[model samples]
Target: MKTISIIPVIRVLSWIVFLGLCIKAGAVLFTFTISLYNPPYAADLYQGLDLSILYSASRLDYIFLMAFAIILSSMQAFIFYFVVSIFEKLNLVRPFSEEIFLLISKISYFSLATGGIGLLAHQFADQLVKNGLVIGKAIDFWEGRDAFLFMGGVVLVIAQIFRRGIDLQVEHDLTV
Candidate 1:
């Protein structure tokens, strides 16, 4: 079997991931918006997660926490979107290109930003819980910050490798 055959499968999987993230972000945003007008909705906002205590404790904090969740989800969706783009532009014959390098770098940077934001949100939720809000479940949304950071580092290294490949391809072209 040729590796080229696998590209479509990977692209389809990336699309699935991208769509799932978008749905997650959208669901959270919709729940947050609805909860603003319908406070009772806060009792079960997006899945089994409840933020009623946080809402009852401090509206500002609740809003901020929800904002962070939405941003983190959206950023994750954006990263997968770029991955799909990379797959779309991929050419097995000439895998190294400036565009691919830039896209990979963008994914790395976005992953780093998402990880940072997730960490901040995680800490903020912990503080809120410590301050007397039952936000234990809220932390679930901000989980996996470390994983994103690690993925960012790995992708950055891959991007650098692609950069070198591009340089070598260019040198070979010049010689020919």
Candidate 2:
């Protein structure tokens, strides 16, 4: 039996995920915009906030936010590819250098840390807004557990990133 290369598989999966995220983001933006124009719906939606005032804000704001989220999601996907690449490259090398392996490990650790921080911030803000708490006050609710799931998600992804790094390192060491 022949083993297939993991890097190509990961790249394909990353592209698929990125495309799916793009589609979802587009649908969300469309729905949000349509909701604004429908009178009865718009009245209910904009009860406290002024519809005209919100619409007057640049459409680019929404576009930019969506784009940023897409970019972050894509980055998470690419982290998978990165691990696969490391593994493939390690297999090609007769024996991996300890220094290089250490560097790779450090890089993975930092990437995971950064992603975790970002995910935490986003989840915290989202929960604050979702629980009927004002933004300023919600932010104060670090004591709040409403966003525990989101925090868990961040931790889960970070753990995955770390696992990938460890797997790549092991594969590299064993292949030679």
Best by lDDT: 1
Report the alpha-carbon TM-score of model 2 versus the true structure.
0.35
* Candidate 2 clashing pairs, residues 3+ apart or interchain: none
lDDT (Cα, tens digit) per residue for candidate 1, span 1-176: 64457778889999999999999999999999999999989999888678898899899999999999889989999999999999999988999999999999999999999899999998898888788788757777768899999999999999999999999999999999
Whole-model lDDT, candidate 2? 0.46
Lowest summed lDDT over 10 consecutive residues: which window, candidate 2? 42-51
Model 2 bad stretches (over 4 Å): 1-61, 92-95, 98-103, 106-114, 120-176
Indicate which candidate wins on TM-score: 1
Off by over 4 Å in 1: 1-4
Compose the digit string of candidate 2's lDDT tens values, residues 1-176: 99888767775675666566456445444444665465333222211322232224444433333333434444444444444445545544433444435435544553554355455645745753564433332223122223433444565565566566667878877998
In lDDT terms, how accurate is model 1? 0.91
Q: Supply the TM-score for candidate 1.
A: 0.95
Score residue 167 of candidate 1 by CA lDDT. 100
